[model samples]
Target: MATESARSERAGGVSSLRGLAGGGVFLPGDEEYDRARTTWALAVDLRPAAVAFPTSAAEVAAVVRAAASAGLRVAPVGTGHNAHPLGDLTDSVLLRMSGMSRIDIDPDARRARVEAGALWLPVIEAAAAHGLSALHGSSPDTGVVGYSLGGGVGWYGRALGLAANSVTAVELVTADGSLTRVDAEHEPELFWAVRGGGGANFGVVTTIEFTLYPIETAYAGMLVWDLRDAHRVLSRWARWAADAPDAVTTSYRHLQYPPIPEIPEPFRGRQLVIVDGAVLADDAEAERILAPLRDLGPELDTFGRVPAATLARLHMDPEQPTPGGGQSALLDELPPAAVDRLVEVAGADSGSSLFLAAELRQLGGALGRSQPGAGAVARLDGQFQLITGGMMVGEFAKQTVADCERVVDAMAPYSRGRQYLNFQEEAVDPSTGYDASTWDALLRLRKNADPAGLFQANHEIPHR
Candidate 1:
């Protein structure tokens, strides 16, 4: 429950927001408040004093002003994919941008101007019509703004680099309620920060323009094997991935599919090991590269040529909202011995409490090369990434967190002592994702742009 003084302040804020155009505001007890505050991860419950659904930059500015007038801070969210780190919002106003989804494709220029609320699904479909694709994550439902702003790693990252490198411009509504257009040539400092410094640290992004690739289709799909073959398969995968070309990006996972009506018949209630990825090459070339794995003769093989849009579903990620928790680490290497250790702990025979997935993604190639004028998080320095996650429900949720920590601890010797911001499930030191100089630069930029500390609840960058 809010104190009397806090409630009074929120009531004043709601009054100011009611007069705004191009958007709707919901108060704490309003019928739409709960639905408006709902995020992609159901485990995060945000109880803000008010929620604003802004349809345009002007409307977003109005909401920010309303929050200021009521003596509260503002927290802008797209699909709220990383909401767990946002500790508390009782005195904050959530600027929900889901109502402003829009995408404009300039095929001739090989660029797409995407709205803050838009997901990668529409952008992928639209770009495919022009034989083009964006550097998008595995899940198509993830918000474009948040992903790119946090150094997005996707199926094409090995070849094209992090998604933040592809961003060209951003239209943002800053702290003082001023809408500004920033890029390399305009507000270069702010542009650099917004690219991979995390979007919320600056302001609410209204639109972003990014470079796209000319790719209509790619050789991509998944290969599954029974849990009994985990040791051999995972060890072989590690060796193969070490020498794989830049054109190929791959990940191997140990999955436990629950016996639920929503799950597919083949994967339902089954424990399996799977390898899936994308190859930016012709079918013949892809087969030549994948022949070694094919020789393993897995029980299920679905690898083949597929539309670029289909890459979104290749990882079998949940398409709808689901309650889950996850932890990630960047690894210096994944040798055969390390692979064996992973299998010993999370394999089907291990009786692991984690109920969903544990994965290792091969990373190198273009992702390790620094480009001129790249984002704050220019490139990843590690060779592999380890991710462990499970559904958050009942006692299993507690066990899942502990099991994930144990996995990380077991693999500590191979870890690079670094983490990716987008994959982080809990609040951590901002410096964990960047080097000393980069962290200092980010803090200085944060102090300059958000002096009043408007956006401080979500992955905040501390002021110097």
Candidate 2:
């Protein structure tokens, strides 16, 4: 039963959203309001004042103005893949960008420009049509604007650096409901801040552009072993990742699959360890670089050349909305002691109830070097970014969170206490995602651009 005051508030949200040029708006009590507020991370139940689907940059600006007029803040979202931290939106308008998906590729120039709502799969396929590829993350359906803005680490991360540095330009709606474009030459400060600093900290991005590589295909795949080999396999991967050339980037993971009919035979209800990635080289060269790990004897090897576009789905990340939760940390180094601790906590005998125990990305190489005129977050100052994830549903949701945090806490000694905001599903101090100097500069810029705090972000950088 809705209270009289609550009904009035919902009515106000609807009335203020009138005259939207494209798409529509939904307020509480509306038939579609519940569906509109659902995020990719299904566990997060967002109860915003209202939800708006804006189609164009102009429409986005109008939504912002409407929210302001209605005495509410505006929060922009693409796929809501990392929506866990956006705790309270009761006083805000949830701006869903799904209606604005548009992708454009210039094959000759090896560049791509996409609307804020676009997913990486479409962009990658479009780019691949011209015999090129973009720096996309593991999940093909991830929103390009959000991932690139928050610093994307993918199969080719070590070689190409972050997806943020590759971003060429951004078009957004600012606090005052103005559609503005920023690049290296205009609004350079905001441009720099949004690249790796997370766009919502400033405003709602309408479109974005980034570099595409001249790549058709390469030797890329995974090497799988049973969970019992986690200790030995991960140990080798850590050492290999530390000294391996930048031409190749990889991750070591411990995966536990549920024993269900939907799962395939090989991985169904099985506990396993896998090392997967891409090698930007010919078959022989890639094989040679992977020889050390191959010698260790993997039960299954799926390394070979394939179409560049296929790389988007290499990691087998979910393509649909799923109930999940996770935690992550940037580690300085993973010495033998750290490795032992990780295996002890999440290994086969640990009795941990989690889907993915550890997904440690190999950092350094180009990712460690700061580029000239790069964004606020130039490089990740750590050797590895450790991630832990699990399904958050039913009676196990609380246990899942505790399990993920336990792994992070166990490896705390080796961590630099920093974070890769892209992989972070829960909220933490946004400053931990950037350097001390970078955080300070970002705050100053936020203070100038949005003094009234009219915009809300998942990992908000507090200006006040």
Top candidate when judged by lDDT against the true structure: 2
Off by over 4 Å in 1: 1-15, 21-23
The TM-score of predicted model 2 comes to 0.97
lDDT of candidate 2 over 346-380, digit per residue (tens):
99998888575678999999899899988877899
After TM-score superposition, what is the CA distance of residue 46 in candidate 1 from its true location, in Å? Answer: 1.0
Q: Native-vs-model 2 lDDT?
A: 0.89
Q: How much does candidate 1 score in TM-score?
A: 0.96
Alpha-carbon lDDT, every model: 0.86, 0.89
Clash total of candidate 2: 0
Instruction: State TM-scores per candidate.
Output: 0.96, 0.97
Candidate 2, clashing residue pairs? none
